[model samples]
Target: MSIRAVDLFCGAGGLTYGLQEAGIDVRAGFDIESECRHPYTENNSDVDFVEGDLSDDVSNAEIEEYLSAGEDDYTLIAGCAPCQPYSTMSNGNKNRTEDHEKWGLMDEFAEIVADIQPDLVTMENVPQVQKHDPYDDFCRRLAEAGYHISDRVVDCPNYGVPQQRKRMVLLASKHGRIELQDPTHDPDEVTVESEFSKHNFCELEAGETSDDDFLHNARGLSDTNKKRIRHSQPGGTWKDWPEELLLKCHKKDSGRKYIAPYGRMEWNKPAPTITTQFYNYGSGRFGHPEEDRAISVREGATLQTFPSDYSFVQSEEELSVKSVGKLIGNAVPVRLAEAIGQSLIQHIRNEDPQTQLQTV
Candidate 1:
């Protein structure tokens, strides 16, 4: 049987593109952000990009239509609901209560899975998601629908993503037991230098853009910050700076342990988690190892394992560092998604010997 899929909450088609790379026919992707349409449709031409809020009944119905388009297809519904409410980064924030609005998106995803009863389903989210009641509810509903469920937190570097991202992945199949594939890469073998060196990006100074690659543009840095990065050693913290360069906040005991800000990444290790603010030098450990600026938009996407040539916008005028960074940082690392796709295909083939699935 042919395998057909729909990706919900598909931001810039990262998951959809990865599944497609593994030979799944991902027919459609739905997201609320219209900004995603260009990248999603431009890259994955075969997949229809539907811009809408997935919480609406009409959206769910539209998803159902995509799944049913091919009668002989083995249907799959996959999604990674917006994870801010369940992310560890948001854990200690005072405004977490206000973030509850997104807590229901997972429930909406579950409702669709329960109603559609697709042959296979998968979801990827921050590891903290397991602690929430919505996660338990989502799993319970899948079990009630007769799915064989398996889930665990996975390190992205083990799957060849050049970042230190840990995500919770869940796989559910109606066709007997299913699980993610074992790590395909040795974490040590997937390093920042190994990946970024391959790109050989044109040398760019702070606030400069590559003439050849538009996305390879670095955010501007203040003069003080420039001197700070000049003194910053790879994998070294702000504590390494001279006394005068230290910020008042860093001088305090409370901020002593917070070493990620203004730190440069180590060449031999995976990069720190790519947050939406990665383009800003002061955000986390986002500064380049030798360059006097934060990682460029293209570099951030590379760390997320997006193909080097993946287009984020149609033209240079449309590019916004903040917007593009959010899309790239929030994306499911494409390599990790491809691994999930492989496992699902293998599970289907194992259950039905007559099925033939291909991978790119």
Candidate 2:
């Protein structure tokens, strides 16, 4: 049997690319962000990119058309519904009710699964999502549809991603029981230093861009921020800065507990979680371990396990650090997605030995 897939909420084709790498014929990707079209199409040339909002009237018939387009014998519907409402960062927010609008998106995904009833289904999201009712409802719907479901919190570094991102992964199959693969990497062995050593990064100063690779550009920093980064030690926080260089917020009693900001990643350790603001010097521990600047767009993408040559934009002019950063930060780490693909393939092979799997 041949396996085919369609990625919902596919951002920059990260999940789609990984699935293709593991031998699944990803026929198309559906996402609301029109900006994602270029990267998604450019990187995964064989897959179609459909721009549409899944939460609205993007019909299940259109999705079914894509999944059934090819001659594949097996089909998979994979998605990571917008996770902001269930994100840990949104806890205790004043405007959380406004964020709840996105909570219904999982219901939209579940409805697609229940209606289409694909051979397999999978989802990835922040670990905090499981504590919420939407996640529970999604699982309940899957079980009711007669799918065998398994889900767990995954340590990204254990799956060969060189960052400290923990995500909740789910695998459900109409075939039989399914689960993610065992960890392929030792956390300590996949450090920032080891991963960076694999890439030949052009030495760039704050506000510099490499002519060779536009995505390798670094964000500019203010003079004071430059001084702060220069004083920062690997694995150390703002507490290591001199009192004169401290920000007004850091000088206050309430700010003393916020130490991860204005810090540098430890060379021998995995990096802090990559956020949409990772290009900013004061956002988490995003400073380069030795360089006096925050990590570049390429560096951030690298930490997210996007291949070094993965292009986020078609040309230099199309690049927007803020826009691309969100896409990268929000992406499922490629290696983790590959692991998920591997596990699904193994499950299929185990359930039916006659299936022939192929890799790109």
Per residue, candidate 2 scores C-alpha lDDT tens digits across 136-178 of 9999999999999999998899998888889999999999989
Point out where model 1 deviates above 4 Å.
358-360
Clashes of each: 0, 0
lDDT of candidate 1 over 1-360, digit per residue (tens) = 567899999998899988988888899899999889988999885789888877863456778889885465688999899999988777778488346788899999999999989999999999999998999999999999999999999999999998988999999999999989999999998989989987979778999999889999999999999999999999999878999999998888998889999999999999999999899999889999887899999999999889899999998998987888889988999999999999999998899888665443
TM-score per prediction, in order, is 0.97, 0.97
Best by lDDT: 1
The local distance difference test score of model 2 is 0.89
What lDDT score goes with residue 330 in model 2? 88
After superposition, candidate 2 runs with Cα above 4 Å error: 69-72, 97-99, 358-360
In angstroms, how far off is 305's CA in candidate 1?
0.8
